[model samples]
Target: MLQMGIIGYGYWGPNLVRNFNVAAGSQVSMVCDMNKQSLSKAKKAYPQVRFTSDVNELINDPEVNAVAIATPVFTHHELAKKALLAGKSVFVEKPFTHTVEEAEELIELAEKKKLKIMVDHTFLYTGAVRKIKQLIDDNVLGSIYYFDSVRVNLGLFQHDVNVVWDLAPHDIAIMDYLINDKPQAVVATGSGHFDRGLEDIAYLTFYYPNNIIAHINVNWLSPVKVRTTLIGGQKKMLVWNDLEPDEIIKVYDKGVKVTTTEGKYNLLVNYRSGDMWAPRIQATEALRLIAEEFVHYVEEGGKVVNDGAAGLKVVKMLVASSKSLKNKGEMIYL
Candidate 1:
């Protein structure tokens, strides 16, 4: 069995521990957190595992073949470096690190050490997203036009990161995976209500080649949680709503077409609207699928769908968006 060590037991810790504990061919050998109460809870819940306050203990443990880090954005680089230097594989949560430089260095280190690294972009493993990919591959969505997403929720505000950094990673990762074009520039705007430094509400726009653009809206001040996105194509459209109980993904056969008259040389547009269809999505947990893939990669060495480069792509976009926000929504090239 592959032994695993988990660090940071605050918000997303329990989920990580539970998934790793049940994942086949893997065992949670140790968990590390600065909080004694968190460690106490882990001990009570998972008496089979060990707990420690010193992160170095978990990194140096010979039995722990891998480390899954769910720490803050700033501490990711140092902790991941320590684990990788100890000759253990590393799995880090989203927004891999604060800067692209840190992410690039981690990628290089993992490459030199021949150690596996998986970024927990859990949504990519979801059944709905998988179906979207399948439809895109089959040209069911047809030629893509634009991508738009709005992910807003109230009061889970992070002290260290802004709303964009906290929430945009999800949308950015999904866009990175689903879109055929890479973003060339970023323009963003945000406002800070409680804290003067951190932004609580933000809007980001991406510019890609061939006029294929994308937009993201993230806010922590919203009274209600809203997770929805729409992808428009020439032939069909995809409406994905996370709040829907069943049939979260709806495919719409509606769009506009333009034809030029020969004699008049004028552009005539035709708008078409048809029935909305919802495709079947197997009810599978995204985290479970990601856990299975992590095990498979460790055993078989297959390239993961959410690999290092993919993480880098999302991080790069975040960095650019932050810069744009600082400059008052100025378009920043990537």
Candidate 2:
């Protein structure tokens, strides 16, 4: 069994403990947090697991074989480096680190140590996303034309990172996973309403090779919450609404075709409209699968889709977006 030590018993820590403790190849051995009240709450729920206020105690524990970092983005590099140096695998939260350099350093160190690093891109494991991946791979959505996403909600503004760092990661990671082509450049624009210097709303556009484009809009000041994505293709189109209870994915058999006429400058346009169908999605919790995959890969050396390299790609896009945001929506090459 792979013994697990979790850092940061704040918002996301308890969920990690619950999933890893019950995972097939892992068990939660200890949890570390700076907040005494958090430790007190965790103690009641997990009496068998050890609790500590000092983070080093958990990283240095001989019984722990891996560490799951549920802390903030700024602290990821330090905590993950300590665990990797101590010869333990690491599972990090999304937006991997505050900067691309930090992510690269941790990835190189983990590679040198032969330790596994899995980023918590929980959405990738969801049934909806998995199904969508299948559709794209099977040529159901032939030759993707564009990817557009909108994720917005009011009032959950973060203190450390802006809305792009906080909300755009999920959509960006999803777009990165679905599209095989790498983006050539990116443009972003946003503004901050508060004194924290963190933008509350942002718009990002990524230019991909072969005419594929991706646009993402994220906000923390919307009147209503929306999680929706549209993928347009030559043969068909898809709509994914994450908030839907039963039907999360709807594939439409629709397309537009252009043909040349007899005249030199004449042209014809044809729009084909057909039926729409919703694929059946498995109801398994994505977090549970993520926990299981981390443990299995650490124990058996299996391949993981959301590995350190995947995290780095998402970070690279984020870095480009930040640069563009600072220069008033200037295009930054990747």
Candidate 3:
């Protein structure tokens, strides 16, 4: 069994710890948090697990074979590098690292050490997303047209990263995994309506190498939480809403039909609306599935759905988008 040390028990730490501790072929042996209350909560949750305030203690522990970093965005790179350099496999929360260069360096280090590096892009592990990928592969959606996603909620303000980095990674990662095409350029526009110098609202657009397109809207000032995505295609369309209780995902058999009328100057755009069906999703926790996949990667060193390389790709896209935003939404080529 692989022993894991979990760092940062704040927001996402408990989920990772719970998932790892119960995951097959893995156990969370140690947990670290600077907050005493949080540490107490961690200890209470997993009585068998050890607790520590110093991350180095967990990293230096010989019993731990892997370290899971669930800390702030800025701490992921250094902590992950230390874990890998110490000859331990590493699993980091989404976006992997802050920049593409950091991710690439970590990937290179993990390769040199022959250690597994997995990123926690949890949504891709969900049955809904997996089925979506399969449908795309089977051409059920036909030729891709556009991807539009809206992820917004009130509050949960992050101190380190802006709204785009905090919220858009999930959508970007999902888009990258679902589509086979690569993005050529990104145009982003954001404004800091809340805290000074921090973007509270942002919109990003991706121009794929193919003629496809993707647009993402993320904000922290929305009145209500909305996790919705629409993938449009020539054959059929898909709508994924995470807020739905039973039917979180619905496949809409709809598309825009264009036709030429008699003596018409332009083609008429007809709306084709058909049926909506929601396939049964495996009702499993995304974190648990991610933990299982990490163990699977540790045992079998082949391609994984969210490996270090895939995380790096998403980081590249994010960095490109951030650059575009910094340049007043100028088109930034990757």
Tens-digit per-residue lDDT, 203-292, candidate 1: 999998888889999999999999999999989999999899988999999999888888557889899999899999989888877877
lDDT of 3: 0.90
Whole-model alpha-carbon lDDT for candidate 2: 0.95
Please say which candidate is ahead in TM-score: 2 or 3.
Answer: 2
Worst 10 residues of 1 by lDDT: 258-267
lDDT score at residue 222, model 1, on the 0-100 scale = 94
Q: Write model 3 residue lDDT over 1-334, tens digit each, in one string.
A: 9999999899998888888989989988999999999999877778888999998999999999999999887888999999998999999998799988899999999999999999999999887888888889999999999999999999688888888889998999999998887889999999997557879899999998668999999999999999999998889898888888889888899988878877578679989888988888878888888898899889877889788999999899888988998899999998
- Which regions of candidate 1 fall more than 4 Å away from where they truly are? 262-265
**291-315, model 2: which lDDT tens digit per residue?**
9999889888868889999999999
TM-score of 3: 0.96
Clash pairs for candidate 3 = none
Off by over 4 Å in 3: 259-270
Clashes of each: 0, 0, 0
By lDDT, who's the top model here? 2
Q: In candidate 2, how many Å is residue 59 off?
A: 0.2
Show the lowest summed lDDT stretch of 10 residues, model 3: 258-267
C-alpha RMSD (angstroms) for model 3: 1.6
